[model samples]
Target: MKPSLLVLTSLPDDNRERIAASFDILYAPTHEARAKSIAKHGATIRAVLTNGTTGLSASEVDRLPALELVSALGAGYENIATDHARTRGIVLTNGAGANDDCVADHAFALLLAVVRDVPQRDRATRDGIWRDALPLRPSVSGKRLGVIGLGRIGEKVARRAAGFDIDVAYHNRKPRDGVTLRYFDNLRDLARWSDYLVVATPGGAGTHHLIDAHVLEALGPTGFLVNVSRGSVVDTDALAHALKSGAIAGAGLDVYESEPHPPQALLHLNNIVLTPHVAGTSPEANAACVDTFIENATRHFAGEDVLTPI
Candidate 1:
């Protein structure tokens, strides 16, 4: 008999069909459905497919006595009970590097959209307002960019910045080897030096609200901020206040603290642009992630090590 797999996140029909060919699927993409399915199929389930956002809890893992592997569809596993799962000998894997290009592309898209005031200009032009009626935006080329995390996505973002002649610097827990880019020991110092600040850090308790009022103030009145990382990294209240009070020139966000719902605090601000957390979402990226998950799961069931272990 094929191993049973519990799916906790929604997937495209084609992706679902692909997975169905490998294992017997127990589809549960909502809270209510998840509870019902887990209660009914816990004993038979040997594996699970989830995303970073809809993580598997320790309690849920405990109930699945047969579960041997857990796979996250994205690079993040912040919400997963990793330590507890490890204690039970459950293998954990993630889709790292699967969507790097897609996310890097979207990060630049957000940066340009906010810095050039693209959305606002599109609206003004539609209403017959000419260039003279609008305020002049700053040139993107030759500006200094500060990247918060120097991970795979950050490296891609820096490469793209090169085409615009933008100088790139970064801040991490420590300096990365072979990375000759300027490294800032402190986030405030990086913000002060950068004309554009892009956040690409992971989400977790450690990085929650890393970007607050003080960092925004250091970014200054002419600086712009872009967040392609998890929303928890930047405090929404602080960001709204910063934009409204001119602490920072403008902002662009792909993720926010309040997800699935628009950020209430930032809705009234004209200096900010928001996208519904789709930085790593494209048909090609999604296919890569799904393929990564299947490969990891297949290897795990075959008594082989996973490609990207968390």
Candidate 2:
């Protein structure tokens, strides 16, 4: 018999059909009727597929008496009650390496956009304004690039940087034992040494607002900042102030302090580029992420250990 599962995010017909063959999926009731559905059928659920923002909670875990696994469709599992899951003996997993390449590509894209002032340039050209300000745009290649958090995605970002002939340095909790790349003892030090500072750290209380005023100042007026990591990693108000006051050269952000709400502070600035939190969005990344959940679910129900345990 297939184990029963629930999906908070709607998948395409192909992915949905694939999973349906292996699990008895519990369709999410209407938004207004969700509470009623959980109350009535929570206990029978054995698996749940959700994302970081819309995570499975302590109360929801308690309600699902038979739930053995909880999986996130991306790298983050922030809102999920990890402490509660640990106590309840429920296995938790996420798509760790799956979306890494896609996210790394976005990080570079954002970095290039800010350093070259692509957004402002495009707008000016479209509005029939050219060479009036014809402001200087910095060269991306042949500069020192500082990467914060050298994880799988960070490594990928570095691999691409090599093609541009940019020297890469990184700051991690502790320096990696082997493999080349200068290591900085602190993030502030890395910012000071870098022409471009790229943040790829994880999001959570530990890393919340890690890039504050001091780090921004360290980046200096000629430096560029790009964040493809979690929003909480950078202080929005401080970043805006830095850009406005010209304390930092410019910034490029794919994620912000507020997920859905636009970062109003950045919108008005001609020196910045913003995108909705879609850094890890790509067809390949999406499929691989969902496949991780399917594999985790299958392993859990088959009495095997999880692949990417959290």
Candidate 3:
């Protein structure tokens, strides 16, 4: 018999079919469905597939006595009860580098869109507004770019910046080994030094609102901020105020504090660009994510070391 695998995310039909070919899928993408599926099939479920946002909780983990693995289909596992799962001897894995290039691509798209005022320009051009009527936007090239986290995605962002002749520096809890890019132990210092700040850090309490009012002030009137990381890392209220008051020139965010719904405060602002948390999503990325999950789950069931253990 195929191993029972509980799925908690909503996937496209093709992706769903791909996974279902390998396991007996529970297919609970909604909240009520999740609860009902767990209650009814708890004992048979040997693994649970979830993403960063829709995490598996401790109570749910406890209910599934047969669960041997919990896999996050993306790099983030912030909401997953990792510690609790650890205590229960459940293996955890995430899609760490599966979408790194895609995320880096989106980050650059946001950066260029905001810095060049692409959205506003498109609107103005459609309105028959001449080029002279628009205010001058800053050049993205030859600027100091600060990256908040220098993980795989962050490194890719830096690489993209290089194509534009941008200078790159980054901040992490500790400096990454064997990188020639300048490193800052302090985040505020990185913000102060940068013309554009791009956040690629992980979410959770340690990095909650890592970019706040003080950091914004340090970024000052001419700087730009971009967040392709978790929304909690950048305070929406603070960003809204900054954009309104011109504390910073503009911002580009792929993630925000309140998700699924747009950030109400930032909606009316023209100096910001927002994408619906799709930094790591693409047809290619999605396929890679699904493939990574299958590989990890398969290896774990075979008593082999799974790739990308979280």
Candidate 4:
């Protein structure tokens, strides 16, 4: 008999079919439906397929006593009560490199749109306005780029910056191997040196509010900021103030503090570009994520070690 699995969120049709070919895939329509499905069918479910943002809870795990594996596509696993699951001996894994290129692409897009004032320019063109009234926008090429938390995603962002010929410097716990990229001991120092700052740090408490008023001030009035990482990494109020007071030239963000609900103040600002936290989401990334899930799940159920734990 094939292993049974439950999909907590909707996936692309192609990915769904891929998963279905290996496991008896079942979809849950609602939270309540998920609980019901697990209670009714948990005995057969060996795996759960989910994403980091829409994570599985401890209660949900308890409902599926037979479950041995939990999978997330994307770097975050905020929704899962991991401690409880760990105690129960259930393994957890995530899609780390599955969407690196896609995320780097979106990050650069946001950067270009903000620095070049693309949205406003397009709107003016649509409203029968001309460039005579608009101020000159900054160029994206050949600027100093300071990237925070230089992990896999951060490295990807830097690699893209190479094409633009930007002076790239990054901050990580330890220096990366033999790379020519400049390393900064402090975030403030990095900000001070950068004309444009890109945040690619991890989310959670250790990095919470890492970009406070001081960092914004260090970035200065001529500097620009971009965050393709977590919203919690930035202090939203400080950022809004920075934008309002021209403490920084402008900003571009793909993620926000409130997540599904973007900040109310940002709605009125034209100095920034905003996206609904979808930097890492794409058809290609989704497929890779599901493929990772299948790899880990298959190994776990076959009484072998899983791939890429945590």
Candidate 5:
């Protein structure tokens, strides 16, 4: 018999069907259903499939005594009880590189949309307004683009920026190997120097509100900010104030503090572009993520080294 798996995410129908064919899946995409499923079938569950946002908690993990492997369907796993799982000798894996291209594509889409005022211009055109009536926006080409995290997604963003003749620099906890791009030890310095600041860092306590009032100020009146990272990284209030006061030129965000609810403070702002947290949701990316999970689970069950361990 196949090992029983508890799936906590709401997968696409095709992905769900694929997983069902491989494992005895206990689908629980809602909180009440999750609790009930755990209560009824926890002992039989040998693995869990979750994502970064809908993490598996320590308390939940404890109930599943048979769980040996936990897989995050996407790159981030900030909410997962990683330390607790490690202590219990449970294996953890994530879809680290699976969705990088999709996310990078979205990040560039946001950056271009806001910088060029694409959304606003489209609205103006539809409302019988002419190009002469609309205020001019800055050119994105030949500008300095600063990346907050130089990981897989960040590197891809930098690569895209290059196509527009933009110079790239980054601020990571430490510099990555084999990269010639300029590195900034201080995030504020990077912000001050950049024409556009793009955040692609990991989410968690350490990076909570990392881009706050001071960083926004450093980006100054002419700069723009783009966040494809976690919402917690940027303070919503600060960003709103900056946009309202013209402290920064504009912003483009894929993730925000409010999450399922839109950022109330930024809703009325005309200088910002917002998208639901969908930086990595493409058909190709989703397929790659699920494939990565299956590979990790297969390797772990066969006593082989799991790929993309977190």
Candidate 6:
């Protein structure tokens, strides 16, 4: 019989059909359904497919006594109970490079949208307000950009920066080898040097609220901030205060601390642009993510090492 696989996150119909061809699927994309499915089928489940946001918990892992593999369908495995799964010898994998280009493209979209005041201008134009009445926005080209966590997505963001003639620098735990871009050991220093600060770091307890009030202050009154990574990486309260008080000029966010629901604190601000955490989402990206997961899971089932293990 095909291995039983429980799916925790919602997937497109086509993607679900594709996965169904490989395994016997127990589709549970809702909270109530998840509990019901687990209670009913936990003993037979041999694998799980979930996303970072809809993670498998330690307790959930405990109930799935037969689970041998856990796969996150995206680059992030932040919310997965990785240590617990590892202790049980369950192979863990993620689609790390699957959506990098899509995310990088969205990052630049946010940057351009905020810096050029596109949304606001579009609205003003619709209301018959001309360019002369609106406040001037800064040019995005030739500005200095500071990237946090120079991983696959960050590297793609930097590569896109080259087309705009933007000078790029990065801050990581340490300098990355073969990366000739300027590295800042300190995040605050990087913020001070950059006209634009793009956060692309991972989410977890270690990186929670990494971008707080102090970093926003260092970004200064003329600087713009963009976050394409996890919402937990930037503090929502601090970001709202910064935008309202002119600590930073403006911001564009694809993720926020309060997800599914709009950020209450930033809703009243006109200097910010928000997207519902869709930086890594696109038809092409979704296909790539699914393909990566299938390849990894197939390899794991075949007694081979899974690609992109966390």
- Better model by lDDT: candidate 2 vs candidate 4: 2
Per-candidate Cα lDDT values, in order, are 0.95, 0.87, 0.94, 0.86, 0.95, 0.95
Candidate 2 residue runs with Cα over 4 Å from true position: 27-36
* Every model's TM-score: 0.99, 0.94, 0.99, 0.92, 0.99, 0.99
> Model 1: which residue pairs collide?
none
Q: Write the per-residue lDDT of candidate 5 for residues 69-154, one digit (tens) a residue.
A: 99999999999999999989999999999999999999999999999999889998899999888778889999999999999999
> Could you give candidate 2's per-residue lDDT for residues 31-108 as a string of tens digits?
544566678888888888877766777988889989888888888888789899889888999988889999999999
Clashing pairs in 2: none
> Where is the poorest 10-residue window by lDDT in model 2?
28-37
Estimate, for each residue in 192-300, the C-alpha lDDT of model 1 and write its tens digit. Answer: 9999999999999999999999999999999999999899999999999999999999999999999989999998888999999999999999999999999999999
Model 3 CA deviation exceeding 4 Å by range: none
**Candidate 4 deviant stretches above 4 angstroms:** 42-44
- lDDT, candidate 4, 42-156, per-residue tens: 8888788787666898878878888888887677777677889899898888877878888889988988998899999999999999999999987888889998978888888
Q: How close is each model in CA RMSD to the real structure? A: 0.7, 1.8, 0.8, 1.9, 0.8, 0.6
Model 6 superposed RMSD (Cα): 0.6
lDDT, residue 205, candidate 5: 91
Q: What's the number of clashes in each of the models? A: 0, 0, 0, 0, 0, 0
Shift of residue 238 alpha carbon in model 5, Å: 0.8
TM-score comparison, 2 vs 6, better candidate: 6
Model 6 C-alpha lDDT per residue in residues 1-310, reported as the tens digit of each score = 8999999988999999999998999999999999999999999999999988889999999999999999999999899999999999999999999999999999999999999999999999999999999988889999999999999999999999999999999999999999999999999999999999999988889899999999999999999999998999999999999999999999999999888899999998888999999999899999999999999999999999988899
Worst 10 residues of 3 by lDDT: 253-262
TM-score, candidate number 3: 0.99
Residues 1-310 of candidate 3 have per-residue lDDT tens digits of 8899999988889998998888999999999999999999999899999988889999999999999999999999999999999999999999999999999999999999999999999999999999998899888899999999999999999999999999999999998999999999988899999999999999988999999999998998999999998999998898899999999999999998888889999999999999999999999999999999999988998999999999
